[model samples]
Target: MENKSKPKYKLILDAAVEVIAENGYHHSQVSKIAKKAGVADGTIYLYFKNKEDILVSLFEEKMGQFVSKIKDEIEQIDEADQKLYKLIEMHFQQLSEDPDLAIVTQLELRQSNKRLRLKINEVLKGYLTLMDDILHEGMKDGTFQDQLNVKLVRQVLFGTLDEVVTNWVMKEQRYNLVKQAKEVHYLIYNGLRKHN
Candidate 1:
């Protein structure tokens, strides 16, 4: 059996993120990433199949952790209303802390082909499912509007966050993104919550 926990795998992944984020995906070369990882060029092949594999794997690895962390945080909140806030808080906080990952996720990743975009969307379903779970719980508990179109609400919530973070990333990360969490929460909360 192969050891999947090798530190070099993570090093290569991290280096790929930085290299791709700095140079658009089309411009990022395997040798560049390998050098950045401080490993031989041939070593990258031991972990990933090719450049496309690295890009897809990067999304899976990073977004997998992102979803897992947010899920853990959301599970701890008793009220559905508070869970929504925690969800938003963790999303912003995670990307804010890792600017390179943010750039890769928000900007570089989108530059791939339609087929790749579809694969990325498949990975995104995990986060979307988490939001659906929250919205359903909120409705059940009367925290959010009972008549809310669950699908639309989920898109609205995720779409708003996507836009805000993309804007922040495009602007060169000049402002504090996590600080916008409370404001964003209130905006979405007022729209979805029953009492308003």
Candidate 2:
């Protein structure tokens, strides 16, 4: 297997995202990804076991970076509310910047089988954990209601963002997605905020 740190691995993953987005995962072939990556078809197998592995690895690598970037950006801010806003903004901004990724993640990936979906969910846990941390921080700082249910709030937060992106993708990204981040943040923030 090729070392994942190699530039070729990223090239394969990025090409996979574009290919899968263009042709649904079931329709996308290893040769297609290899060609896009400018590598031999055999080289794909050096980094992934199969198409399923590629899909799972793609999610793992992309979501890992997504969560890390958001975590780093939010860490610089002190307030939980602003952190939440930044989280929403970054989520939208990143997806909007990479429309192919948005299509693969939001639409194409959902067509996978039960097992693949579960594997994708495993990769999603890191992102969920980031959201959980933000929620817990808000509660601890008295910015959010102490009585808030962290788990439920986390699901709601993720669901809201996921739905927004899915809608944007489904609509062919006609409108500006990042612009809606503020309203999303406002809805989620008000739901969890402590009321006088």
Question: TM-score per candidate, in order?
Answer: 0.96, 0.98
Q: What do the candidate models score in CA lDDT, each in turn?
A: 0.92, 0.94
Give the per-residue lDDT of model 2 (tens digit) for 1-196: 7799999999999999999999999999999999999999998999999999999999999999999999999989999999999999999999999999999999988899999999998899988888899899999989999998899999899999999999999999999999999999999999899998
**Root-mean-square deviation of every model:** 1.4, 0.8
lDDT for each residue of candidate 1 in 72-151, tens digit (9 for 90 to 100): 88888889989989999899999999999999989988788999999999999999999999999999999999999999
Using TM-score, give the best candidate's number.
2
In model 2, which regions exceed 4 Å deviation?
Answer: none
Model 1 clash pairs are none
Lowest-scoring 10 consecutive residues by lDDT in candidate 1?
1-10
Error of 2 at 147 (Å): 0.7
